[model samples]
Target chain A: MSNLKKDSLFAGSVKDAAAGGLVALALFGMMIGMQADVATGLGGQLGINYRWGAVAIAVVIVFAGRLLLNLFVWKSDKPVTRTVGSLLPKASSFSGLGRFATPVFLVLAVVLPFLLTYFLGTRGSRQYLDLAILVTTYVMLGWGLNIVVGLAGLLDLGYVAFYAVGAYSYALLAQYFGFSFWVCLPLAGILAAFWGIILGFPVLRLRGDYLAIVTLAFGEIIRVVLLNWYDFTGGPDGLSNIPRPSFFGLDFERGEGNFADFFGLEYNSIHRIIFLYYVILAMALVTNLVTMRLRKLPIGRAWEALREDEIACRSLGINTTNTKLTAFALGAMFGGFAGSFFATRQGFISPESFTFMESAVILAIVVLGGLGSQIGVVIAAVVMIGGFEFFRGLEEYRMLVFGLLMVVIMVWRPRGLISVRTPSISLSGKAKGISADLVQEGHG
Target chain B: MSNWDNNPVLAIEHLTMRFGGLVAVGDLSFNVGRGDITALIGPNGAGKTTVFNCATGFYKPTEGRIVMNRANGEHYLLERMPDFQISAKAKVARTFQNIRLFGGMTLLENLMVAQHNPLMLASNFTIGGVFGLSGFKSAERKAVDKARYWLDKTGLLDRADGPAADLPYGDQRRLEIARAMCSGPELLCLDEPAAGLNPKESAELNTLLNAIRDEHATSILLIEHDMSVVMEISDHVVVLDYGEKISDGTPEQVKNDPKVIAAYLGVPDDEVDDVEEEVGL
Candidate 1:
């Protein structure tokens, strides 16, 4: 048994290294391309005193650097163990910390920005705050979809429909009734959840590809409705000049009634951005908490059972229709929250903001992170979103690079970044950490 | 035989299952006596599995009444119930011809899922489960204990955490039986449980069946091609040929019947005398 585990560990490390190497090589090639472009100006018409010898030297230097790093790691005894230990510091603690980790990380995420701004000062913190907020939103979206696609095994191609519903609900409600952000948030979630139930009822008998196609159609239908409904949604133009959230009636603008003036501090737009960041962070954390708790519940188990085998789940007396509906409702509710946050953040709402591309990116994060893994989703969001932002300078080739990266990661780990852990039901009625052996056994 | 007052747990009357013009089970009538291990034996396309499917509500009979009497005095018209509800509410559990345990789940989970109804009942539709209720926890613990108990019974306790598909063929067959037994059904229907099992595994299965009959008072209806398994464990044997009943009697009686011999041994009716003479029957 130990030998088998060791072999698997070895195989996993080798695959991970190969993926990392491919990513590094791609980045290196991009850097070389940029240098070449600088040497050869517009349309390759202007040429500088660039030598092919220098390019060869640069390539050799990079190759030697990579080889040396590989040799250092390979020469070290117990390289696999060392690599895995560094990658997953709490590998053994995963089972024990599974339940507590999500909440703990959530609290830390909420407090991290404030701590960073306080300690490091607010010099160029807006970018970091924006990245954090973006990552959090995707994390929430991934968790929401995980309920339907990961737990219930429902392929929802148009999950963005629910997200659009939430954003529009918030936009329309706040616009018409002059409601607060807090009030509009839950309203959006409720409306989106209602749509989820509606979607669920029609696809009760469908499974697999049929269910996926219907969901894709439903998404398109929602988008089309938003596009055609000129009176309510303003047609393709969408709702604009949406109200920004205030801090207890004190606006964040520069004036006597502004938030900074009320609090007796110098006004900076970063404050508003940071405040909004934390607000979205809190929302995302709540989404994660609810999903994690639900997973331990009977409904969660039913979803998993459905995913594993629907026929067997039915045989066990589980009401599959109810289970599927609950999954859809819960997932949609979170998507609604993200949508509301997006509307509030941008101070505008548009159909273009909730396109199918948004859904694809969110789904990609969920899949890359590992289905049903909260932490994996967060990490995936950070890497994919942060990488996309960083590669903005790459121009037309950015998407091509991102696509290659996705393919590389998928080939390296077909099961996703973090595979689903085996569920543990203790004899003492206490929840225990999921064991790796148990996960292997369950996934076999 | 026991008194007729102890009516059969499962009774199929005029059960006829047809696909297009091809009749799989035609006017089949049989009574699976309570606490009896009944074996249904037939050649390929003889409709033994078809009868099991009709009884389990997988394929509704074209013309039949499947009456199943639970030990709790609740009688279920199995043919009328949906496929899922039949196994859930009627307490009529069945194992497939090919072992069909949830391969992605652990061996223990496969068994626990079989006890799904009872667990859900204890948790009251899982409201208690969401609140982390102590009662639900206790119920979950009970499920785990039950799963472990059955795993031990099947000698698969050591492999409880392993995936069902990872088990060897014999172990997989045993695991399937354990999963069905975990459902706590009054009537258990096993389709070819002894298929691909060696002599030792077959003997072990016989022991398990006998134990289930004596301890749980489960009425077992089995479809088996292995004569040894049928002859050793079955209290009654029913033979089918061309979707029609050929013989129904005790194992010894069925073994001695000329029709059963011709159907199973493949000796032509006209040449049976010559074959019997040659074999010194």
Candidate 2:
């Protein structure tokens, strides 16, 4: 028999410790590289305290963690460990995880506000709810973009253009025409979808990188127009005092017929935060539900087919023009919905918020989620947005850690966190999801 | 020939296709008999695919009329319509030389997508589909039934749920044909269906083609390089050389035609007899 455990546990600790120490030192140094010692003319200076101590702790943690991981995981000779090491991750292995992940997430999301309020008190709960709302917004945007990029295989690098259209639509409509958030929401989606078709028609013949470039240009054009056309869009100053969404016309303000007052509860600011969290949670769920339903519909299957092979889709009598247009329009519609929600949430709208970087982030979320995988988008959005928020205190290292985490995840799971895709149609009794590897990359 | 319909299913009148300086197909004319297997054979660069492309509306011929007479007695000027309209309204479905099955989708989805136009109408543009209305549901059920029918006919019912690309090469070819059949095409154009098939698979293809012609009453226009398959299965043959039709007749007549032997053997017309003797055809 082959000697499975020849090396002693402590054989490489010193070398590993030294390597870990060097890495930790470099990381800590990067984390605290440049700082201004702001002294208030008191006895002490306010700056990063004991940068060396932080680095030492980081080194010790890395050394200990690396040693433990190497001893148990890398050196284990158990058959189970060997089997797991030998096994490649597959769509089948992760397929079961998807079945439970959504429900668990939904339940957790539903009870999160109540749980936080009960434990942290109302004043303390606002921050967590705010974070949850931010995460949910990105999740919603990811799902919306998933329709065009993931299911239809269209590479849209200017998705934020639609979000801008939506936000501007709500902002301009409310400012000029005195429309409520409820009325403006659908209008914004309609306007965004209209713009999507307008953008879609001229570029129907373009694919791949060319399509991406054109979409990026279109996004820039919208932003520029919003910036220049001060007369209609308030120019660079942006539109402020945008209306907030209410619960069936009951505002969450501290006046008569306010939500708290109508409900016979004391006027607490946390109610609005909690309410906003649920609103976004509900919108995200609806987006997920509609997308899931569309995945099983004929149009959805047509989108997948179009993605697989446009020539083949044409051969089969599918109207490729209409297919591409619908994907653009629908994806833009959802983006608009999220945009309107954003306008309501911020009570302000600006061209600066809908930048190309926003599009890149949303597109990254879709790709990292695995194209055409719904639940994958949720996980990716949480990881991306939540991680960015979590590392906010590490101002210098925030982007470094975030970028590193993304690179690690991508290297570990090249097909994104969840790569399994449910087939639009199945002939057997049950639907068997296919691996995303079997699918071709989206051309448009 | 017992059930062969005498009417001409597709008529190409003086079809000419040009790519800027090069004429891919020049003055190619032929008639595909209804429910008949017609083969278009040529050497490399003879532009057999260009003819297929023109006939299927993928390319509008530089000059000519492609008149397709459907089973419903509707006549269509195929060149005037877009590529998808040729398949959707003209009821002319085709497969590519490279076997263009939707590799990522289940075999069933590939067929269901072929029925997109009808399903789109049945779903009332997604309003009914979203609500799961019975009208749309029944239409979907029928579409599934049609897909299943074709899958069963192609002997791929067992692999219906798997990705179409996962099937072997020969099966992908059959799946392409089955997917076209799901659209209920009046004429099916196949490009090199027997190119990479084993002898057993080739024989199986023959059975499937004949069944489609005899049972389904679907006319076939195929561009094939395999002489044995063409000679064995095709009821009629058209030969092309240098983008021009050299011969058009029954298989036996085309096989013996001096011009076809000259085209295939790349010999002078007068020396065709000697070339034929050497080629042992």
Candidate 3:
């Protein structure tokens, strides 16, 4: 059966390669043709254009070379044997590599700053630090929401409400009580978790669209409260000059006996940026580890069972209400952590920052990455966030391009980028095998 | 007969299920004796399916007292119990007439899901399941072993990892039975088990039912249209006609009854000769 499956997969890959090669060749041809036409039009207008037609010819030659490669490899029956043999080692290697992913990631996290400093010096290190902070923050949010959307299959449109609650909680607590960032972070998480439970209670009976609508309303209500409760939140003006994280008595701001003077290092903003980056990274790793652990737990299995079939889950005597609430609370708690981190990093808190669009983007990251896939979510965040940053120069066209890319991806891979082929772990520690029945019938 | 007064596996007292204006099961009173293969044989829409639903807690009867006696000596008012609780507490497992297996799940998973209640109990209401305790692991192993046992029993062990939907029509029906059996129910309610099966499959089903009755000691309440399956496996048969019980006796007795024949025809006047001709009496 394994050999048969391997054979079939090899055949599929060959077909995919041939199809991809043909599409690439066609695209190359079109690019060349369009470029030549543009050059001729430029020559007509300016009448001083040099012969740049060689570029188009060169592109065509490259396309032909790719076509020949496809014909030589993809068209042969021997390709199946070669593909199967080559893929077997890679598949085995992947299984072996899976065990070391966590350790490898941990090492990279510790080593990344030094690597950046060594290669790009202080100026470039600051930019890398900023990127790391953004990625880690989003990664934390994604892992948190994974509990709600991926595990419990609850569509939460108001997840950012919890984030907002955390941000505001830290901002309010720190300002009023002179609470440090570390002290306020857990308080923020607790507050968000409380709100999550409250939100979960009302939407317990609602599923799918109704749950989404109610959650969306909940988020909007939180935002509205912040807007109207001017006595506390400062209304539309928002909280400003929120106290940043300090190492003991040393602050990030440039002054006598500040962080730089305390540490005997030059006063660069990279100090704070690097600190925030590591903070968020640690938080993200914690979220990921906790979620991964939860997935192996009974509640995790119950969540998956519920997602697959609610009736079956209930019949199993699983208390779905509690299960759902736990998911919401846990996810919301992580979101709160990220929010607190954001507040501390930016030294500001505002309702405008935690808008519906922020929630949509995070949710998109989850979906685009693939539901219930941690690695997929991280990859999705990198692509989406980096893509958005890259297209920042396009201004008005950025959204248009982003929207088009999403539509194209959805069309090609409706299941998301890294669709979960099988469950992560079974309650029964049996050898995992792809059920032919499931393969034929598709997912529930 | 077999000391039903001690405690019937399933007892329906004054069961009347009304679908708006129409009564589907009207004051139907019956007792399914312990370890008996009782067939609820009737023409189409004779409330056999409705009775099955009511017994399985799928529908709340307009008026009824459905007392389900568990193997552990606990009695449950099934009508009052929620669908999940009925399966979990009452231990009254059932298969749908249309074979409602979780098509997307593997055959093994389907069977394992049936043992969900027991596994939950072993895990102390899923707390151990969450923590992956030794108890939970043992329970899970037991559940998997039970699933495998049932799959093997149903001649589906080889196809255990195959999705239930991908199974052939006959195999799918057998898989459904295997799933229900995995629940370890004292009272197994099979609704039209032979509906879409061929003669050979139907015959195999009879053997399977008999084995379940004898070996597992499970009292079965079967709603079947196939005369062969009804006549072969049913120790006792109850005939219904338009929400009313026409006859209730042994399979031979119900088969030869004039009232049962008339009920089948839907006309009282055509009973005499038709009954004689059908039963060759």
Candidate 4:
């Protein structure tokens, strides 16, 4: 102690480093300190193997890392925001380059399939096109759920039930009624919106956790009904042989009277993929367009106002009942459209596809994109769905990476990416985005 | 009480609100004369808010009728209606004791939300908005103009684009009133408009309330604890104590009432009933 540096700052850094080492020890003690493996190379009983060296290394690294952070970041006199999240990047980029971000992304989405085909050629383009189609479907779903969770501030854990409804509506209608894909698409959306209203009525009075629990149960109930009702729905066998969407009335199945024959082009399966890609792109863009328009309408303002303060909304004579139901119906309508497209794209419908995890992922996209932000939904969907696909080879670490990313995002931008809100009706045409803190994230 | 034979915007007849066994308000009645400022004055927990809530359709009175009469001679049974109908069909607007501005919306947006009924009808319930109909566009412009008009009146036009949560305490209070006015209400109910304001702001609120009564055809009904505010601009005063009316008259008449003084100044317990009876409650 007598030989140690006299400076208090040095002492403080040492103390912080020591504390970090202790925390790392406490955290890693069980997970990494002792491994469960056979000590011998030969077959032996599985037992605890002490790895004190690993623990020692972890502690040393933690200590060194903490020391560096304290010296260069935390204790610096330059007013540093000392946190890993804050260290990454401030979410202040809603200006400058942000002005063109939407247009750039829109252009990229429109030309993605052709761009991929141009670069990767015929054989290689299929996989990337499929990935793009899958991501666009999720973008559509994220925007749909954004209506309920983001704009209206209603926490709906049963959102996938509407998706399931749309998928099944299209499948059953085609299988039984002999309807085409185009006919079933709008019908599927209508049916899903009807179900949304049915779900909305019972949960009208419930708020926060109660609403979440009911919606979760509702989603499960829909899946359970689909799974167990074998006679009409084919039970666990699931509905299959759903028809594909036609260009006007033309199919793309590499035969006479198909898309390629009609267009006088090669009968490549990539044509179908390309067509489906455009179909989903168009669908996703329609959802975005409708939602953006809604945000400026009285109904959209009513939804947002209800989210901010339901009592205030009611006091102002805004019909909260209609507002909530419209949110559910409109949100479910988009989910339904996406679901119908999903069924057509996959040519199969099953209960396994519409699970609670799907709802959570869509919700995660909405939350990560920032509630009430239309463009945020697009960015979050791409980053999450695309990133998930990118890490598909590392299946076990994929979730670990995803969870770590979520934690980082929560700490960094607590309100989600692009959290700031553009005012719906700005007197000054160029009014700046409202701070994320000023935007209501909704109670539920 | 001033007679409302010529006209009355709101009439609360035998209004009784009972929560379980406790009587929050019991057999209370008052009439707000058309285009006049009527103040409901009471101390803490004297059922002033309860009466306001009942009148605004937040609470259905256990018994009695809350009648709102428009200039067209159409009257609404307020307690029979929902909270929104009270504000919408009955043309009544209210502010909270604790301000309930849509904190996320801008001052202009907050007022525009109050004009939702009119704009919703004009936009054809949002379907027409998608098509960019000229009618809806013009309605939106008119709605903005109305919001701006209220904003200018409240002196918040400069900060119309700013978020409501960012306003100062006094400005937020005034903004609440402005938002209520944008609804085009025949009757406006204000709850503690001068709450938490300094003397200067309180005086400004007095001027604003007087200006509203003078300039607009809207009648004002308010719940106020601030005696200075109650006495300055009130055209009529109704005092409540322990869920019962102790006095009802003009501000000068009510201010000098012995029972009003006794209820406010806290007289001897034995003389309390005497004061209550002398006032014929």
For this target, which candidate reaches the highest DockQ against the unseen true structure? Answer: 4
Which runs in model 2 stand beyond 4 Å of their true positions?
Answer: A1-91, B1-6, B267-280
Which regions in candidate 3 have their CA more than 4 angstroms from the true location?
A1-110, A176-187, A241-268, A424-444, B2-6, B115-132, B267-281
Give candidate 2's chain B TM-score. 0.94
* Chain A TM-score by candidate, in order: 0.74, 0.82, 0.74, 0.91
What's the ranking of the predictions by TM-score, best on top?
A: 4, 2, 1, 3
For candidate 1, report its TM-score: 0.80
Candidate of highest lDDT: 4
List candidate 4 stretches off by more than 4 Å.
A1-89, A96-98, B268-281
Ranking by DockQ: 4, 2, 1, 3
- Give every prediction's interface RMSD: 4.1, 1.2, 4.5, 0.9
| lDDT string, candidate 2, A1-444, tens digits | 244334554566556766876887788766754345665675577764346666677778888877776666665545345666457565468887888998998899999999999999988878778989999999999999999999898899999999999999999999999999899999999999999999999889999999999999999999999999988998889999998888898888897788988999888888888888988889889888898888878789888888889998888788889989999999999999999999989988888998899999999998898888888898888888888887789998988888898898787688888887777666776867787778888788
> Lowest summed-lDDT stretch of 10 residues in model 4 chain A?
A78-87
> For model 1 chain B, where is the 10-residue window of minimal lDDT?
B1-10
Q: In candidate 3, what are the lDDT values of residues A222-303, reduced to their tens digit?
A: 9999988999999888998888988776888787889998878879877877777777888898888878876655566566
What fraction of the native alpha-carbon contacts across the interface, defined at 8 angstroms, is recovered by model 3? 0.23
DockQ each? 0.27, 0.69, 0.23, 0.73
Q: What does chain B score (TM) in every candidate?
A: 0.94, 0.94, 0.93, 0.93
**Each model's C-alpha lDDT?**
0.79, 0.87, 0.77, 0.89
